[model samples]
Target chain A: MNIVEKILARASGKSKVSPDDVVFANVDKVMMHDVSGPGVIKVFDKLQKQGISVDKLWDSTKVWVAEDHFVPSAEKVSAENIVKLSNFTKRYGIEKHFKYGMGQYGICHTISHEEAMVMPGDVYVGGDSHTNTTGALGAFACGLGHTDVAYVLLNGKIWFKVPETFYFKLNGKLPDHVMAKDFILKIIGDIGTDGGAYRTMQFGGSGIDEMSVQSRLTMCNMTTEAGAKNGIVEPDQKVFDYLTRRGATNLNLIKGDSDAEYEKIFEYEGSELEPVVAKPFSPENISVVREAPSVELDKCYIGSCTGAKYEDLEAAAKILKGRKVKIRTEILPAAISIYQRAMENGLLKIFLDAGVTVGPPTCGACCGAHMGVLAKDEICISTTNRNFPGRMGHIESQTYLSSPLVAAASAVTGKITDPRDLK
Target chain B: MDSFKNVTSIVTPLDKVNVDTDQIVPKQFLKLIQKSGFGKFLFFDWRYDENENKKPDFVLNDSKYDGSKILVTGDNFGCGSSREHAVWALLDYGFSVIIAPSFADIFFSNCFKNGILPISLDEKTVEKLQQETRPIEVDLEKQTIKTLSEEISFEIDPHKKKILLEGLDDIAQTLQYEDEITEFEKNSKIPSVL
Candidate 1:
């Protein structure tokens, strides 16, 4: 069995498992944010009305909460939702709630790794689709809906039809100008949006071994865009060191067997990869940076769990250090920890010096929720995943998805400029 | 949750692929804590103009799909986000059955939990159903969708079918296996984490 297969098999108490086999896997950790937190609370309410027990969770310690998506309170309603989330957490005795404005609050996926909430060999599930991001840590991480999360809260387990694995092998190191974002976008482009549906996308090879844990995270984060159930890389020394620095201890790494099976294998030469962007309306609608549509960009947003990591910010700062942005650009870190690191390392100052507004960490405009969404007919280059119609703002507003480097370079020129093409 | 009743209605057709949850219920409306009122916000951008006037060109505004209990759309419906609110909005708007060529994995699981029956059929069958102007009958007991001209059979997991048929609360149903779950936990060796 592969890493995902072995993890799921162990969690479910199965001696062996195969793709499409249904197993009720015991969950190690679960997460819900303000948006899904309230939704799960509502599910609990409905369950109570149905005469089911909603008194306590199976294990409160395994459950964590985050306040993102509409944090800093998008409005009175969102404010009330935050209050509801707080009350529910207090009532349930969930101690790991990352409260907004209190400290260390940010996107749920970011907090998962930053706070070391999940570890390798754990079956982690969250209410948001991008929960797949944490799979980069070698955990069998997947996203669930509010009701499913509500179920996990009470049952500590949920049924899953094990997914077939798609092994992605990268040979050689990525070019300096190309980042994980470009490679994932290229994969999504080659395989349509539903190509990975009900399957796992696993990364491995010389390139993955050479990549940083943060870069591997960026790779897994966008697996949601391809409709994958989860994304993973086998745990290794780099993963152990990354987690150990983040306070994780007693780590037990999980790896695939020598005879592990994959449904398919796809290989890419990292040295031949180039910066790419996903055009408007679909993540699979991708084009190389040099061949991208030449349009005036209204905004450049460098934020979201997909981007805005410390390394992502460093990449952007390197591009923006001695250059001024020609458009309205925002650099919102994915977490307060990342925010502080960027601040301490002078990445924030470089962004501010480059005529960019350094904002607080939040899901923000990535989901079209507050904090500088695009207006009608506006165009943007974003480091966030997804560019579907109305994804970032008005129905007609367009977004071109690119790496932080490309977004920073585009910010400098107010056009879709590749970092290599930047003046 | 309501038990699955054979639905009979004029099928609403959304001739678009990858109809994401964001469009089904946009981010702005997600602030509402209650799930009941989302019917008004379903397809907020497509169903209405900026000033909140109805857009005549959208399929929902054509009056043909009024009170539609079944929505037949292009492939990969409900493709983005794991929001259950999308299913809530669809159900609140009176949709009980959604027929598509494919659906995003999370959204597909969400439908059964919410008592919405999402059926996957071949593209040609879905397109043929989409073009059917007459009211269609979807019978879960028989596992068949009957239009005026043709009857199409669909497949579903027996367990999922039983859930929709019985309107069983998922949490309550799972609790019945508490002994099994506890035994699994006791016997399993879980790795330690930070």
Candidate 2:
């Protein structure tokens, strides 16, 4: 059996399994956020109308609620919803609720990992699609609908159709300007976005050993762009080292058998990869920025759940140490905790000395609610996910998605240019 | 609901992949949950210029796709963040059927709840559909889509098919299961606080 099969076997208490089989697996963890929590609670209310109490069904330790987007900026309706959800959390005695103004909290996807709610081999589900980001830590994580999340909230069990696995074997070393985001964009461009629907993507090969934990997280975070359910990189020394640094012990390390069967396999050499960027509106519409003339940015932002790791910060700081941002730029560390760690290590000072305004560690500008909104006719180069026009607040504004290094260099130049070219 | 033994509609073609929720309806529009009047904001960024003037380069501005009730798009039609407003905006804009090579799981499921039919076809079939400039005939009752050169039949879950055939939303469908759900809930164990 494959890794996914093994995880599902343990989850379902079954000895063996295969792809395409439907199984009811016990959920290890269930997460929700402000946007989806209210809808789920409403469904729970309907279930409660029939006298169904969920107190006995769920594991209190495994449930988490995060108020990330629109935290301080929450609209009246969503704010009321957050209040109702907080009431539910209080009634249920859930201990791991992060509210607005809480230090070390940002987007649910990024903050959950920082808070150590995820563990290797854990079967996790969140009410947001990008919950797959947790897969980078070797967990079986995916997204579900509000109804399904509500059902899990009520019963602590959810159904799944096991999917086949696709192995991506990486080789060679990535260039200075090329990073994990470019690799993912290139893969999506080659596969045309839907190539891995309902499949598990497993990253391996010598190149996996070369990538830092932060880069691997960025790689797995965008598997959703390929329409994949989840993405996993086999645990290695780097992973263990990073987890140990984060104070994670007692991790369950699981790997695929040497001869594990996979539905398909893809191979790419990192040395051949260039700095790629996803054009507006589609991750599949990718081009190497150095080659594409239409690719220009008016603003540059570097920081998000996908690009906010310590290593990511260090890389940006190294590039911007003696440089001034020609374009207005904002660099948000993933969490206030991460920012504190960077400050302790002087990474924040390097960023600040280089003229980068470090915003609060909230999911500002990523979801278009606030922070780094663009002006009309302006464009931004962002490391966050989704580059749809107006995604960063201005409807007429265009967003170009790229890696942190590219964004930093673009900030220094006030236009979309290659990081290596700045040197 | 209006009744029809047979219904057919023409579709517009926009051959771009990964049409995310933000593109369908900007996050700013999410502030209002009234679930109506979002048609004008569908594809808000791509359809409009800096001054809020319509960009003639957008497919929606093309006269040929005017009043099109169906949308034919590229593969992975809905990706990125899961915002149900994407489905709501599309439905409010008068698009009932969306044909693509594939769709994101969350967006695909959301479309069914909003009484929109999201059809997934093979790449070859999608290309063939894209080549046809004229509006194609789509018959929900027959589960068949007809073009100038070919007729394609697709399969749907029995319950989902019933809902689409009757134009019923999720709330309406759940009311049918209310009796069984209530019985199960009544006999369930009470939850305990940790």
Candidate 3:
């Protein structure tokens, strides 16, 4: 069995579990965000009216609530929703709830990764699809719906049909300036958005072993756009070391069986890969940065759970050094800790010196919630995932998804230019 | 969630592929927390121009697709983000049936929970459905789709089918194992990160 299967089998208390078998496995943790919070509580209220009263969450300790979408109150309604979520957390004694203006909160995905709340062999679920980001920690994490999350709150378990695994085997070493964002964009291009629908994408190979935990997180983070239920890397010393640093005393690493079966396998030579970008309207529509079409941008955004990591921000800052951006540029750290680290390391100063605006650690510009909303016919080169129409603003506004290296270069040039073309 | 047994209506064919959740319900409109009141904002970007006026050439704005209950779209529909608001927006816009060659996994699962029938027909059949200008009929119990010219059979998971047919939400289904969950919670590892 693979790591996903082993985790499900253990959670379900089954000796063995195979693909397509329905099982209600014990949920290790259920996460929800401000955007999805009211929906969960709405369903919870309906369930309570049905006489299924839950004074406390089924397991108060096993729940995580975050407020990032509408920080500092985007509007009256969103503020009200935050209040409702705060009240729910208070009533249920959900101690993990992190509201805005609170300490050390970034996007829910990055925060969960930084906190190491998810462990290997655990089955985790969150209301947001990007919850699969935690799978980098070697957990079977996936996304569920509002009512499904509400059900997980009432019961510590949720049903799943064991997903077939698709092995993404990477070989060779990645070139400098090429990051996991380029690797994943290339993958999404090869296998279009629906490629892994209802399946698990188990990333493997010596290349994965050598990659940083940050790169692994970015790799698993975008698997949701490919329609994968979960995207995971086998637990390695890197993950263990990271978790240990975050104060995990007893670590039980989970790995797939040596001879585990896979539904299909895709092998790539990482050395042959170059920086790639997903053109507007679809993450699947990708092109190598050098070969991209002639286009300019109204802005360049370098933030989000997928892009605003310490390494990612550092890469962007190095490129932006001694150069002023031709257009608007935003650099957001993934968390307060990451923000403080960049500030201490002078990476934030590099960005600030480059005429870039450094912002708070929120999903701020990524979701087009408030800051960085593109206007009509505007275009942006961003280090965020998803280039869908109207994702960052007006339907006519376009966004090209690229690595931080490309985003910084594009920012300096005010166009979709290649980082490799820089002097 | 509402119970769904049957739906019959004229089809609205959207020809574009990879119609993502962002286009279904844009991020800006997601501020409205309530599930309802999203009908007016369905495809808000496409349905309206920059001036907030209705676009004349949009599919949903066409006179032919007025009051359309069934939508036939290209492959890989609902392909980004897990915003359930996308599903709510579609349901609120009075769409009971969506016929596609394929759907994003999360969005497909979301359709079932929201009392909407997402029927997956092969690309050939979906293309055929797009050409028809007559009423389309869907029967969940029979798992059959009837059109002006042909009848097509569909398959759904037994659990999902039962829940949809009986109008049982996740809470209702899990309530059956309430005692089991309570016991499991009592025995499992308590979260330490909090």
The model with the greatest DockQ is 1
- Here the TM-score of candidate 1's chain B is 0.93
Better of 2 and 3 by DockQ: 3
Return the top candidate by lDDT: 1
Residue A296 error for model 2, in Å? 6.1
DockQ ranking of the models: 1, 3, 2
lDDT by residue (B42-128, candidate 2, tens digit) is: 988788876889999998988877888888898778777776667768988888888898888778877776678888889888877
TM-score of chain B of 3: 0.90
Q: List the residue pairs that clash in candidate 2.
A: A55-B191, A55-B192, A56-B191, A56-B192
How big is the positional error of residue A268 in model 2, measured in Å on the Cα after superposition? Answer: 2.2
TM-score (0 to 1) for chain A, all models?
0.99, 0.94, 0.98
Give lDDT: candidate 3, residue A328.
94
Lowest summed lDDT across 10 adjacent residues in model 2 chain B is found at B1-10
Please give the lDDT score for candidate 1: 0.92
Q: Mind giving the per-residue lDDT tens digits that candidate 1 earns over A296-348?
A: 89999999999999999999999999999999999999999999999899887
Q: Give model 1's TM-score versus the native structure.
A: 0.98
Q: Order the candidates by TM-score, highest first — what do you get?
A: 1, 3, 2
In candidate 2, what are the lDDT values of residues A36-122, reduced to their tens digit? 777677666655665556555367778998876666655577677678878988888888888767655677877767777787777
Question: Which of the predicted structures, 2 or 3, would earn the higher lDDT when compared with the native?
Answer: 3
Best by TM-score: 1
Q: How many backbone collisions does model 1 have? A: 0
lDDT of 1 by residue, B1-194 (tens): 77888999999988899999999999888877687888999999999999999999998888767888989998899999888899999988889999999999999999998899999999999999889988989999999999888888999999999999988767767767779767767877754331
